[model samples]
Target: MDHLADSQRVLTIGEGDGRFVAELVRRFPHIEVDCLEGSSAMIARARARLPSAAKVNFYHVDALNWEYPVEIYDAVVTCFFLDCFSDKTLREWLPRSINCSKPAGKWMVAEFREGVGGMERLRSRFWLRVMYLFFNWTTGLEAKQLPNWQGLLDELGYGCFEKSETSNAMIYSSVWQRWENARKTDGFNP
Candidate 1:
């Protein structure tokens, strides 16, 4: 977080309960973070679990209609928050979020990328579909495949020059550095 220069203004789209978000604020005491979450319950909880650091701000906002500051962030991160939307909503958000992202900025997303073993696959699929039916309808998310995000970024002109994965490939995350001209010459050392 300290490495990010423009992260002085950081935003989390679905920042529920400030605990996890507070971790970032705690680490980067000088950096300011603004979190947007739709659930009042979650937001209240977040306000309570405040990080030790005082450089944090909170807002009750939805993922789709939330406003972005005129200045972009140096880094944006999503953890287990992207899979809840439908394909249409995902499509809309990808572009909007990419726009919110800064040039040469880092965007990281962590999500469940693969179905589980045999029977578990079927069960997970059923639950995944159910989640889409229930949550996406309310949240206005367009159902989408997890890996398709790479293509979405490419379509929006991000090359995803670096990436990483964990949990036996079932969970993955990638950091995309955006550009307006030539693609940025960036890659993760890891």
Candidate 2:
């Protein structure tokens, strides 16, 4: 939550077991999240495990169809989730992700990172591709290069405020803030 600019509304779009968002709320008691997840089991577990679940209301629904409540959140988070969509679905999800975020609000993403050459990296990438194809076909996710997340944020017109790659390069933690509610229709300035 320290990554957040200040005390404001926050929502976790693809909140899983609600673990990460839960942590966000824990540290910043003022932070609130309207967590949405498609999985019921995960949602139940998250509800049970979260210390701040009372503060963090949750909604169980598909991210693509769920209503975004019209510019209410100061931050939108899609951690380890967006990569599950196909380009078409990604396009849909992105706008909604943006919609949920208030003007000048932040968008944060935490994703698995395929590190540089090594047996570990090679194996991880191979499995990730296979998993993406399987899930993409099953769930209709894009499943391609969701890495280089900074690029993804830029391509969507969200400027990167700060980012960090895991020591093993196994994950990327990113925060991007939109300049305004309306995106440029093209992408980033650069």
Candidate 3:
């Protein structure tokens, strides 16, 4: 959360069970957070997890259809959330989602990724397939494979400045900032 220490407003999409939100508020009590979650059950769990005094607004809505406020947030966070959608959905949804943040905003993402090489790649592929199959069967998730999220973010004019991988490179966390030129050319107005 060091990256968000100075942020006044933050948005988190599909933040399950409020663990991250609770920790976020605990670390930065001054920040106001808006959490968009599709599941009411998850939202209830999240609300129960947080102290009543927390500066959190829980929106029980799907990110794809939610009308995002214009340039209102300092950062956007998605943890294991974007992987639930198909590539086509992401291409259309991500730009709109990121638009809610200011021109100099940060986007923090933690999600599953295919491994780099060798046995790591093979192991990642195996686990990913299993995960997709399980989630598809249980949750009716539309994504059968992980998309090139990094490439898509690049196209959206964001550049990754910090990144790390764990779980044998099957999972990654990264921080991204909008390119200076993108601020002027991306066409979103504050």
Candidate 4:
């Protein structure tokens, strides 16, 4: 949220139960937010959580397929959301996510990361596998493992301005800022 202190328009994908959105609306009264979530119940809960005067729009739509707003948002947030996608799906959707933001916009992500080594790596892998199985069975999620989101973000010309890890490197949060040169060289207007 600190990375987005100056943001005016924000987009949040998979804004689950609305805990984050509720606080975000309260803290940043001047900012407008568009929140996307697939579950109807979650959307209702999110709506109910927000204050009456909050400047927020809720969309009960799948993030992967929803039409992007096109280079308008000052910041894009996807907390614990991107891990649900396979590499193929991410390859298709990530660019759309980027294009939804302005040329020099901020992108914030928080999700599970594959651990580096030893016991930590084992623990991470085990839990991820369990999560994959459970989500696949329950929600029909496509990804069997965590996607290399950092790699894709780097390839798309985003620089990690801030990052932190916890749970023995099994979880990470990062703030990415898009580079001007990257957008120009890549011809990624809009």
CA-only RMSD, every prediction: 4.2, 4.9, 4.5, 4.5
Model 4: per-residue lDDT, tens digit, 5-61? 788999999999999888887888888999999999998988999889999998989
Candidate 2: the clashing residue pairs are: 85-141, 85-142, 86-141, 86-142
Scored by lDDT, the top model is: 3
lDDT of 2 by residue, 1-190 (tens): 5766474688887787868766777777777667889999989988887773357888989877886787788878888887665456666566665666666777778878676788878977887778777876786755665534455566777776566787767777876776453244233332
Name the regions of candidate 4 deviating beyond 4 angstroms.
180-190
Residue 56 lDDT (model 2): 82
Better of 1 and 3 by lDDT: 3
lDDT of each: 0.65, 0.71, 0.88, 0.85
Quote model 3's TM-score.
Answer: 0.93
Clash-forming residue pairs, model 3: none
Model 1 per-residue lDDT at 62: 73
Candidate closest to the true structure, highest TM-score: 3
Per-prediction TM-score to the true structure, in the order listed: 0.74, 0.77, 0.93, 0.90
Model 3 segments more than 4 A misplaced = 181-190
lDDT sort, best first: 3, 4, 2, 1
> What is candidate 1's lDDT per residue for 1-190, written digit by digit as tens?
3334447767676776666677776666677777778889988888777755566676777767766754467677777677666556668877765667567667766676655478656766676667656766786755544436666766777666555666455566676665442253544332
What TM-score quantifies how close candidate 1 is to the native fold? 0.74
